[model samples]
Structure formats: C-alpha cells, structure tokens
Target: MKRALVIGASQSLGSHLATRLASNGWQVVGTGRRPASEVPGSEGFAYERLDLSDPEEAHRFLEGAGSDAYDLVVHNAVTYGAIPGKPPALDELEAMFRVNALVPYRLLHGVLAAQPTDRFCSCVVVNSDSIYHATKQSAPYAATKAALRVLTTSLADTFRSAQVSVATLLLGPLPDPRKLADFQRVAERHDVPVEDVKRAFLRKANPFYVIDDLIGFDACYRSVEYLAGLGPAGNGMVCRLDGGSAGSLI
Candidate 1:
C-alpha cells in the first residue's frame, strides 16, 4: 500500500483529503494540533497530535521512528493572520510565518534526510491563490504563503538528487461550512447580523470572486493525487487549482 502523511488533518480541507486518501486504499497517517477524539472525522485514519507552532514538538515528531516511510507527504496546516482593517501585530506575524512557512521547511528537511537517496517521495505544500494578488485584509497571510511557494521551489531544487518531488498546490476560496459558522459566531459577538458578517467575510476571502470559482475538496484531492503519482516528473510544479479565478494579466 502507498503510505501518506497529511499534516494538519483536523481542518476541513485536510480532513476531507485524509479521509479520501484512506478510502482510496492509501495507508494514511494524519496529524493535527487537536486530540483525535475532538476531531470530527478522526476514524478514517491513524491520527497524531502535532503542534506546528512549537518547534521542539515538531522536531521530536520528525525525528521519531518511522518518520521517513511515506511515499507522499502533504503539508496542509496553516494559520491565518488577517486582523481586518489593520496589519497583524509583529508577534502574530511571526507566529503565522512559523506555522505556514518554517514548519513545512523543517518537516520536509527532516523527512528527506531520513529517506534513502534511491527511494522516491512526493511532497505537496498547500498554499493560497492570495499570493497572486494584493489585499489589505490578508496581506500578512498572503506574504507567508508567498514565502512558502519560494521555499518549495528551493527545496525541490535542493532535493532533486534524492528523487524527492515537491509541488505547491495554490487553492482559491473553498466553501467550507466551518468558515460560515465561525463568521456567524463573530457576528454574534459584535451584535451584527449573520448575513452582513458573511458578506464581509466572503468579500475578503474571495477577492477574485467569479461565480462557481470556489474549488471543491474532491478537486483538490485529485490534484494532489495526480501530483503524487508523477514521482520525479512533477518536481517544482506550482499547480493552481483556483478554477481560473486568479486570471492572467498577460
């Protein structure tokens, strides 16, 4: 069986991907900051608690036994630093960068180091289409993703001789129900209508909002599966799964 490790598999997209991969016969191991019992879809695969914000914890997990026994590794964990109307605090920005960019770099470096040079492994970093455009609300978040993209490219080049393939999957806004619920809670906290909060959230989240532009979990799974199947051929590929919402200027 093909083994895969999915980081941050507690979130909506990550949960869906992990479940799908398990259903498709992959021996999947998923990591999340939350405990397995607290995660909704925890039964689909083996679960590990990994706090990406803590460097020492992440380092220990990476160096643990059987860390390099995977054909695919997907870095799906991310932290948003958008404070709306103003930039995030310096400390918050640093935290966001650590989770979004540095964690993946460390995770991949540790995994690759343990793998045999002759073995093949595929790594996918989930990024955002926000890196392709400018926006005040999510500027800090976008900056971190941009840094991740560049880091993926550098890793791909550096690990070419080891038969390790790295790809960045740039996704647009996804119609995750959890986001709407979170927005509703925010509205309640501020004594605003849910619809109004929803509108504002969507406006900020989907800057290039064309009808039917939101990418689905299935589409993302297929993209990742295809990239993983490519082995060495898909190294350094930046696959944009945004349904063309990030339009070309050229």
Candidate 2:
C-alpha cells in the first residue's frame, strides 16, 4: 500500500483528509498537536503528536522523520494568531510564522531528502485565499500564507529533477463549526449582532456571493486527490478552491 503522511490531522479538514485517504487503501500517518485520545475519528490511521509552535519540538520531529519516506505528503497545519483586529505580539507573530510557513519548509525538506531514488512523491501544501485579497485584521495571517506559496514554488523547482512534485491548494473559507463559534465569540466581544458578523464574513470571502454555500471538505479532498494524481505534471501549480470567489471579479 502506498504510504501517506498528513500533517495536522487532529481536526477539521486535516482529519477528514486522513480518514478519506485511509478508506482509499493508503497507509496513513497523521500528525497533530493534540493527543491521540483527544482526537476523534482516528481509527484507521496512525497519529503522532507534533507541536509546531516550538522550534525545538519541530526540529526534533523533522530530525526523526528524516529517514522515513512517504509517497504522499500533505502539509495542512496552520495557526491564525490573535484573532482579527488585535495586533499580535512579536512572539505570537513568530509562532504563527513557524507553524504557517517555516515548519512546512523543514518538514518537506526532510521528506524529500528521504525519498527513494526510483520512487515518486506527491506533496501538497494547503494555503488560504486571503493571500489574494487584503484584510487589515488578517494581514499578518495572509503574509504567512503568501510566504508559504513562495516556498512551495521554490520547492517544486528544486525537487523537480528528483521526481517529487509539489502543489499548493489555496482554499477559501469553509463552514467549520469551530470557526463559526469563533465568529460568534468575536461578535459578542465587539457588541455586534452575530448575523451581521456572518454576513460580513461571507461578503469578504466572496464579493460576488455567486455560491450560496461555503466550500465543503469533500470538494477539498477531491481537489487534493486530483492534484496528487497528476504526478510531476502538476509541479509548481497553485490551485484555487474558493468556489470561484477569487475569479468572480474578473
């Protein structure tokens, strides 16, 4: 069976992708900051505790994983620091940068180094659509994502000769319960109506509002699978999975 490694598989999109990959007969190893006991729906795959915020922990994990090669690797871990409107401290920004971009670079470097001479590897980096549009509140988060995109492109170029392909999936907002709850909390804190906050979020995510519903996990899975299946031909590709929101303005 082909082996796949999913970084940040504790919850939300990461968990869904891990489960789906296992169901498809792939031997999957998933990493998350949460303990295995705390993570739900982790029956089919192996879970490892990986906290990307600490440089020492991240370096240790990379060092240990340097010899283990995976046919498919997905970097899905991210941290959005300080919630919007609040300026993040220097340490917070550093942590966010590490989790959002730097850790991924190290992880991919180790994985690609261990790839077998004759084996092919497909690597997917999950980014956000916020990179295209600017938001004062989310400017810091968007900067990290933009940095990730540049790193992914460079990786694609550097590893092309080694039979390793890298692609970036620029995803839009999804209906994650956790994020919805966060919005509610923010609205309450700011003394604004929850519905107004939701409406504002939707409008910002998709100015055209062409699609009534947010993008689902199934769609994201399909996009990732499709890109992986493309092999080396999809190298350096940046795919937008934002339900046509980014291009609607064109």
| Candidate 1 C-alpha lDDT tens digits along 1-250 | 9888899898789999899999999988899898898876779889999888899888889877337588888989988765667778888899999999988897877887677666688999998988877577877888999999898899999887777899988988776776767877899999998777766765666655553434789999999999998989889998888745577553
Find the candidate with the highest lDDT and give its number: 2
Clashing pairs in 2: none
Model 2, span 1-250: residue lDDT tens: 8989999999999999999999999998898998898776788899888888777877787777635778889999998887668889998898889889988887787778778978888999999888877677888899999999999998999898887999998888876778789789989999998877877778766585555556789999999999999999988998888767566655
TM-score of predicted structure 2: 0.89
Shift in Å, residue 191, candidate 2: 17
How far off is residue 180 in model 2, in Å? 3.8
Clashes of each: 0, 0
TM-score for each candidate, following the candidate numbering: 0.87, 0.89
lDDT of 1 at 109: 78
RMSD of 2: 3.0
Residue runs of model 1 more than 4 Å from their true location after superposition: 182-213
- Worst lDDT run of 10 residues, candidate 1, spans 205-214
